[model samples]
Target: MTYSQERNKKMHSLLYKQRVLLEHTGKSSVFISNDSHKYYTNLLEYIEGDLERNIYTIPVLRKAIKTDSYEHLLKVVQFFSSNTSCLFDVKYCYELENMEYEDIQADEYTNYILYGTEPVTANGSEIEDFNPKYLSFYCIINMD
Candidate 1:
């Protein structure tokens, strides 16, 4: 299949998966919440950009991980680490597993990379730091 066809297929499959998740929540199928709709819309946009611009996006990375597309996944990781103001946390078990499965060296993965200069805060004065780089990663993994 051509690249465009592959991207369309991926988007359709993701939409179908989201529909199934919505069904499981016992919500009306027609009433997709604004947040969910926005998420899907952003996801489609990212996928299209990845295909057309030859750039890797977060959804692409997540799909690569899911399909065991290790090389592409690594490329995404590297791209986020170097090119974007994104930070990645390597704490999740699944992420660890992906790293191991792909035989990615620990050093190669940017360590404690912070995505933004401004500190992330919660509960006024309690500061939390998060890597913004993996925003795309989170979006893809959390896609219902």
Candidate 2:
């Protein structure tokens, strides 16, 4: 198949998997699995010199949070699909049954949290200390 055709097929599969995950979990948002850490690390290493970035650094994160977490995942997939030869996959996307917030944050896949908070406008008012809950996203990026 052509590159575009293959990308489209992968995108379709991603959407289907996300839909199934939403239905099974009864949650409006879905995140990539934590098991995909190495892939993300590899992606960061390819994009930057080190794994110093996280999902929040993505330019689309702010916009994605305004909608739903799943939207962020879609945008991320679309970005890699259109811009690079990397194959992004969420085959390991699954809920962490007993993981703690601290544990999740410390995970190599999500260790990219900024130490400071930025003022965020909420309900038409600017909240100085708005700490919004973030959904973790992890996916495999097979650089071809």
Candidate 3:
């Protein structure tokens, strides 16, 4: 597979596992709170230069939560699945080396190498690097 295709498949697998874990842990679904909305709004605005330029909007999230429909989040995930390169942090992409689709589906430890939510630190300091461009298109939709 091409680099982008491999990356996209790996990401899909990670998200699938995460959702399964969330389901088993009694969480009905991930919710986007007010703070999350604000954070994502800022991130999207920075990346896209304007949220208006994108198809997604802040109000859409508000409406989803109100109506108890997570279709918006699903759509975002679908977009991310296809545009993994746009949302992935290129700096850490080296970790993806040698990971095939089959291995990703079979390995329970894929999270540690991929999108692990737990903080990773170096020299007693936390490091954060989120891909801004298309991340605004998807992850903010979860923001739990």
Task: Kindly list the per-residue Cα lDDT of model 3 for residues 1-144, writing each as its tens digit.
Answer: 886566455545554554444334323323334433433233333433322222333344334223333454443333333333133211111122264111112122234436654333223232345322212221232211
Error of 1 at 61 (Å): 21
Give the TM-score (vs. native) of candidate 2: 0.30
Global lDDT of model 3: 0.33
| lDDT for 5 (candidate 1) | 85
Q: What is the lDDT of candidate 1?
A: 0.37
> Could you tell me how far off, in angstroms, the CA of residue 138 lies in candidate 2 after the best superposition?
9.1
Instruction: Kindly report which residue pairs in candidate 1 clash with one another.
Output: 86-133, 87-133
Give the candidate order by descending TM-score. Answer: 2, 1, 3
Error of 1 at 111 (Å): 21
Q: For candidate 1, lDDT tens digit of each residue in 5-120? A: 87667656754554455345324423234433433334344544454333444455455344354444544344333322122233211122244212222322233233333322
* Best TM-score among the predictions, by candidate number: 2
Model 3 sits at a Cα RMSD from the real structure of: 14.8
Off by over 4 Å in 1: 26-144
TM-score of each: 0.25, 0.30, 0.25
- Using TM-score as the measure, name the better of candidate 1 and candidate 3: 1
For every candidate structure, what is the RMSD over all alpha carbons to the true structure, in angstroms?
A: 14.6, 16.1, 14.8
